[model samples]
Target: MLSKRSVAASVLCALLATGATACNGDKGGPAAASAPASARPSASPVPTLAVDTLTADQISEQAHAAMAALASVKVDGELTMDGSKLAVHLTSDKQGNCSGTVASPEVGQFELRHSGSKTWLRADETTWKKAVAKEPGATAQDAAIAAELFKGRFITGGDTRAELAEAAMMCNLIKGLFADDSDKGKEKIAKGSAGTTNGVKTFGLTVTTGDGENLTLHVATEGKPYLIRMEQTQGSEPAAFDFSEFDKPFTVQEPAADQVVDFSVFEKKVKKA
Candidate 1:
């Protein structure tokens, strides 16, 4: 009902009323004024990482990653490689603090307590006697040497660099001996299966080396994927390692003055004798 000029005027009036920069003439709709890029609300970033089911091999790798992040861990293991048949139960921290016992068929049991820069070692009386024996028939001199080593009591292991290194390396040695080696992961022969051990859930996988060595790793699944257990066959016996206490702090306090028999006193005594 309106002339072309009248229609054009109406459209312009409508646009002006609405404050539109442009309206449908060639353009289809009112164009929204763009905000400054800095003022614009940004869309949240999409997560690139995905959570999915993991394979046994994959789980083992993740468990290792978890262990590497830990400050301390509890270890209960039976080691057979050195004929020590060493039964170890301990809590080890990377900063040179630990409390544990290393027992063997030959050496009986040695209580190990390391704190700060000092390591204290005390073998059971029977083990001490056997250690000092040196031979089936021990000379008085051998007995004296044994007494000198212990000063008839707890001995400090921090006197020498090698001794300190040995004390420091003890925790790492136990970790290496029991924990699954990541390098052996690729050779895992079978896929891991979900199973439970001792009422706990786990993801378990087995791997072997080129030389026919085989080992199995079990990773906990209910919570964080942690390496819960490991098994390896050595000769006819199967050695086992159980891991727990991921983040708990283990404290090793110094023995009482009377309880501690410093090795230096024994060294001095032996030098005088």
Candidate 2:
């Protein structure tokens, strides 16, 4: 039999596994008081990167740096988790503006949008129930609201940068592969033969993570060497990601005031009930 702590650990892992979609940041219990937060844009000119005649590490490093300068980006891909597929789609701006949906095998399709630390979410009743059940001290009223009031509607919350980043990373073909503290030798970052995908001529750059996660990017060769496609090894099979809409505009419409419910309402109702 599993001990209580083991079970709790298992549950926590399961909840976190929904990263890039699952709620994070002070989300375990009765919703905390939410203060306004915004993902303001970084005030800097778009960095001009040298992408020509670069090595695999250069490609990755350049791509990570360029990603921040991107005013907006659209990313879509598959994420493999515990042998199941979590398909996701996202569009985000550098200022933390994000809008996307993740279709999880466990909880069905859930959509979330964010402006800075403020987030609005739309999901089915089951997803909401699963979300609140993970809360540290969620009450019966919380469950009721999750089922009736917040069901099938957009609900706002605080601390959304991490959540938005997770949503973006769900489709982020490049990030964390060469995290600051981890390192792999030159052998892992290699150049492969030229190829084409969907009529886009490209060369391949592959980086193997410290934990054995493999990332491969097919970059456009003719023009600016834009990242056209990405593939990552998940389990035995590789998950594919397609990148587009670089530096474009992305807007996540807020739910109408009448249609939205914030956590403060939940706190008041739960306490009174």
Candidate 3:
């Protein structure tokens, strides 16, 4: 027979071995399987975009379209040229017509008219008669030159009658030009709180031309930018043009034969003199 002390020691050892096996089984089963679940990361949230933000391309297109619309509208305004205030007016149907007058301080007054495809100028009755006597079927170029002479200041060199027509086209083209995509070298000039002009909230945008000219545009609440002003420097003198009284109605009429002057006649006379 075994002794009592030995019997007790044997029983204690058996109990300890069973308890260790139970603990190991619990860890290897459910506890081990759940370790990865606790270590894994959660999903991230999505980002939001602002309402007022616009891309550069979008801004350019908006500007261009605004200019185009302005060109399509009837325009009438006053122009101050060389200390003389002149009335400027334009009207366009499906076809187009434009005319204006410049009353100079020193030089006498002159007028310009365009009808259908014809352009004419009346510079006092004497010059008109002289011009008609010289060239009967004179070109639009002749008419523009006569108009410039009547104003006492001529258009710049390389500025032909065709060029003047192009300039007139610009009044309409400005709408589309601003809507074009921005080129690689160009950059946004200004953006922020806009001020009010004539009860209209207006934002200003300034762009530097490739030829180093600085052009400024004023955009209204309707997302259209009108060429309100432009500045250029020649040596020490600075020249500028300001636009106002926009979106008003005005009448543009065609010139009569008696009012038209042929500039070729005046040119030949100047050469002879």
lDDT of 3 by residue, 1-273 (tens): 323333322221221222223222211100001111111111224222111475433444564554445433433333333333333333333234555542323233444444455544444634432332334344444434444454432222122444234323422322323333544366445443355443334555555545454444444444234434333333222333334334434455544444443444454533333
- Ranking 1 against 2 by TM-score, winner: 1
lDDT of each: 0.53, 0.54, 0.36
Local lDDT at 125 for model 2 = 77
* Runs of candidate 1 exceeding 4 Å displacement: 1-52, 135-141, 144-152, 159-161, 173-186, 210-212, 234-237, 271-273
Q: Write the per-residue lDDT of candidate 2 for residues 1-273, one digit (tens) a residue.
A: 443333322322333356543223111101011111211112233333344567777766655555545666666666554455666566766665678876666656677676655667677777756655666655455556656877666755455433334544433322332123345353367676577644556677876655565667776555444565677654553466566676656677877887777644554555455
For model 2, state the Cα shift of residue 34 in Å: 37
TM-score per model over all chains: 0.68, 0.65, 0.45
Clash count, predicted structure 1: 0
Error of 2 at 135 (Å): 8.5
Segments in model 3 whose C-alpha atoms lie over 4 Å from true places: 1-52, 55-57, 70-96, 102-109, 124-188, 223-251, 261-273
Report residue 138 deviation for candidate 2 (angstroms): 9.3
lDDT of 1 by residue, 124-144 (tens): 556655554434333455445
Deviation of model 3 at 265, angstroms? 6.7
Number of the top candidate by lDDT?
2
Whole-model lDDT, candidate 2?
Answer: 0.54
Native-to-model Cα distance after best TM-score fit, residue 123 in candidate 3, in Å: 3.4
